[model samples]
Target: MFIAIFSIIIVLVVLGALFINLSPEFGGTISDSQKEQFSKSEHYKDGVFENLGGVTMSMGFGDYVKGLKGFFGPQINTRPKGAVPINALDALELANYKGPARMVWFGHSTFLYQSYGRNILIDPMLGPVPAPHPLLGGKRFSEELPIAIEQLPQIDFVVLSHDHYDHLDYGSILKLKDKVQMFFTPLGVGAHLVEWGVAEDRIKEMDWWGETSFEGFSIKCVPAQHFSGRGLSDRGKTLWSGWVIKNDGANVFFSGDSGYGGHFTEIGEKYGPFDFAMLECGQYNKLWHEIHMMPKETAQAGVDVKAKVIMPIHWGAFKLAMHPWTDPVIRVSDKAKELNLPIVTPKIGEFIYLAEPTSNGGVWWKNVD
Candidate 1:
């Protein structure tokens, strides 16, 4: 009996190892030159990227075991009862519409922001599953998107927050390679893009607190409380960050998968009064609280960033956590009301005009069992 159990454990271990090595979703490793570049950043330490507040990557082995159990435990209401409603925008009309700074949230931290005559895509994760393979990950709540990747207009810029599969999808990047003119990512992340066939010249890698100029906009890589890695051994090989997009006309702050931390107030002090703030407000658990923020903390993050309007993102698409699918937005809505913060809850593919952001305030997901 003992031999049988031990042999089974060995087989499972070997299979897991093989899978990690074989999965293309694990992405590319940091080259020696990339390592040298990463070492130059203040955030890089002990041969890995470090978050502010000296955050540790893992909770511990015991907690990890608990997490694994929780992951396989029974989950309820993960997917909506019916097809998630989608309002497909006319791609051609959106491309030609010269209007105020507008954005269309494709759900779960994916959005296309157009303003100042440039089209920018932030975390264009159009893939149906967040994992490397559909068999390994939960399917997106809404199977059909408003528009397919081929339907997108000429993308001027692509902003990547990190190298996570959900945010930096290998499939999506491959499809977008020809359409996108430029890619901006944190330090060491360009390695993955380069591996995936993005031109080296088209990719701009920046460190935390680094700033770059593109067209009429000034893009700043800001700090976030999060760890980075696509695989077990490669944790912290790349940097993670939020972004601040500012121009003479308006400023936009995008919280790219960060936990609640002092960085919020710091960013607000440096770049306050943003026209809009898009923040992660989902996929949080007590065990991994250091990596992802709760809904109330997400609202406070908006206030800390001094945003004129706060929109809850990183929800409504994939079920990366055990919580009920609608728990995130519902909690955030209550928190925003408590804090008296202006919130914009737009339906998927609905264009959110930044200047006068309006949603029907419909609890569209409520009726979805």
Candidate 2:
């Protein structure tokens, strides 16, 4: 009875929110040109939607009942007894983030990269809960962004992997609209931006490998083995992808969120030996393992990109999966050591210098097995 009642409430709230996000008055998503253009992509044109539709129909209402059970299933994410306070990030302050090229893990997938005097943030999920309701889910360790949206200093660009609530929060975008210089995301994501009152000129969209230019940088949306749908209606209507951000001399590959696949080798050969790669390293289980890579697969992905140094991300924010909170980091480290992959693990708010951020030390997420 408890699960059923709460689930109905969740469904109602989510439906109401979706109505606002999808309505012409709220998000101006009535324009159909972007949708027409998006369907031209061979992968999303017909295949992905069919697949997702099939999955949904097969599940029926009963599957979601089971999913809710899974949601409230055994909890495995308790913090370590006498675990380090969130202060390990002091290492960043000790250095004063003034390096030529560096990246800071803001917990989960949010990271600030400073290179060539340009600052870019990838998937800045600063909210406490990835879900719409805080009481209904896990919590963020950090109180707020290390730098608030307004406090962000002349942000050059913001890149998004997809439109999942965890990746694209409405509150953050509304707060950042006036502050950010430009925004880049895969094709249909511009719908959300446009509805949020971002000018069409400021919003740029791309398909896989579709390139667009910023003054000192070039962004290319790359492929990821993932699904996309913020609500029931938008599934596969928008595209999901990883991204390759490049300057003249440096290449940074952000595995926005994905399962390990052949695209790794493809990206490596095309953008190999990257100075730094920030890859997803958490919130995975057998049910969706094909969509989110396990920790050892993350290490293999590092090698696939020919990355010199890998900073494992996507863990330590909200507990989305059953694995112990620290499991992702520990498993990746062990795999990195086994594979001889150079991995740079940093605490929340700590910055990693692209040149050699490893000289000091890394003890960020060191607890789980």
Candidate 3:
């Protein structure tokens, strides 16, 4: 009996190992040279990336059981009852777009920013699901993307916030790599892209506070209080970050999957008074509040960053937490109103012009069941 149980355990371990090794979705391993380079960053110590002040992902065994219960428990309104409304992108209009810069939210954290005729995609995870396999995480709220990956205009830059499956999809990268000119990521994240087929020369890995310029735009890799990993074994192996993108025309901030931290104030001080800001506002629970901000915190983050206008993201696409699907936008909007801050709630694929940032589509989610 003991021998049979031991054999079964061995077989299970072998299968798990094989699955991780054979799966391309797990992403690339860090090389010795990459590790050496990462060691120089203050955040990199003891061979793994550390968050500022450190985040407690799990308090203890009780917390783990609570998390499990939350995951498996019956939750209502976690997803929209009806199809999420999305607009089809006008390819000709996008290609010929001119003037004060514009962006389109592709649900969740994905956005297509066009400025001076250059197309930049941020966290372009356009796949159906945010997991290694479709069975693990369900499909996105919307069945079809505003524009198909093949139909996207030639991309000049692809800016990735981290190596998380939700933000950095393997299938999306496979389709985007050929058309993209350059890829920007936080430290050690390029290894994943390189492993996936992106040319090493085309990828630029930036440390926190690192700044660079391409054409007329100034791009800075800023700090975020978040963790990174595509597979179980590689947690914190790569860095995660928000971005400050600016040009002569407009300045923008993207709070890439962060919790409430002093970094927002720091970012604002260094590069604040942003023309627009897209902040994370969903997938938050009390247990994981240190990693993902609540909706109210999302509103305050906008004020901290000195943003002229803010839009709540990291929701509306996939249900990563137990909250109702509309809870994020509603709570954030209420908080924004209380703070006297302007907020834009654009529908998926709706264009948000920087010069005039407002919600052209009014409260569309209220109609959805």
Candidate 4:
């Protein structure tokens, strides 16, 4: 009986190893040279990326059980009863766009930002599931993207914030590689791009505070209090970060997947008074609050960054936490009102023209169940 059980355990272990190594979705391996290069960043210590300040990510056994109960136990309104509403992209309008910068949120953190004919895609996770396998993460809330990936115009840039499965999807990259002109990612993230067939010259990896330029835009990779990993064993092997995009027309900030921390203040001081900001405002619980901000903090982060207007993102697409689907916008909107911060809640795929910001699509989620 002991030998039979031992054999079963050994077989399982071997199968798991084989699956991780053979799966393309697991992404690329970081070379020793890449590790040495990553070692220069203050955030990289002891051979792994570290968040700013002390962050508590590990939960005690009791907390772990409680989280499991909260996730699997009876829950209400975690997802909408029907398909999420989304606007179909007018490709002609996007191609001929010539005015103040416009953005279309494809739910969650994915966005298509257009300015003067240049198209930038940020965290373009257009897959149906956020996990490597569909069965693991379930389908996205929306039935379709703003537009089909194949129909996208020539992409000027593809910006990535990290290597997490939701933010850096394997299938999306496979579809986007051919049309994308350049790919910008934080340190250690470009390795995955290279492994996935993107040419080395077309990828530019940056450290925190690193700056680069393209055409008329100045792009900077900024700090974020977040962790990174895609597979089971590669946690923190790559860096995570936010981005600051500046041009003659506008200045923008993307808070990437960060927890509430001093980095927000630092980013504000360095590049404050942004014309627009997209801040993460969902997938949070007390058990893992240090890595994901609650809704109130999301509003305050806007103030810290001195954004003229803020948009609440990282919700509306997936049920990563136990809260109701509408809780993020509700809580963040209330806090923004108290703070007197202008917040926009555009429907999935709706065009948000930065110069003429409006919340005319009033409280759309109130009807979703």
Cα lDDT of all candidates, in order?
A: 0.89, 0.74, 0.93, 0.90
**Global Cα lDDT for candidate 4:** 0.90
Which regions of candidate 4 fall more than 4 Å away from where they truly are?
1-11
Worst 10 residues of 2 by lDDT: 49-58
Best by lDDT: 3
Write model 4 residue lDDT over 1-369, tens digit each, in one string.
999999999999998789789989988989999998888888888889888775658789999999999988988889989778888997777777777788899999999998988899999999999997777796789889989898888899989999988899999999999999999999999989998999999999999999999968899999888898888888899989999998877899999998899889899999888999999998899888888999999999999999999999999999889998999999999999999999999998888888876765789887676
> Which one wins by lDDT: 2 or 3?
3
For residue 366, model 2's alpha carbon misses the true position, in angstroms, by 4.1
Give a tens-digit lDDT track for model 2, residues 79-113.
Answer: 44333334333433433444477777777898777
- Sorted on lDDT, highest at the top, how do the candidates line up? 3, 4, 1, 2
RMSD of each: 2.0, 4.7, 1.6, 1.5
Question: Sorted by TM-score, highest first, which candidate order results?
Answer: 3, 4, 1, 2
Angstrom error at residue 104, model 1: 0.3
Per-residue lDDT tens digits for candidate 1, residues 1-369, read 999999999999999899889877777788887777677788888889888868864688998888898788887886677878888878888678766698899999999888856889999999999887788898888878889998888988899999998899999998999999999999988888888888899999998889999877899999989988888888888999999988766799999999899999999999888999999998888889989999999999999999999999999899898888899999999999999999998889988888887786378887676
The TM-score of candidate 1 is 0.94
lDDT score, candidate 4, position 152:
85
Candidate 2 lands at a TM-score of 0.84
Pick by TM-score: 2 or 3, better one: 3
Deviating ranges (above 4 Å) for candidate 3: 1-12
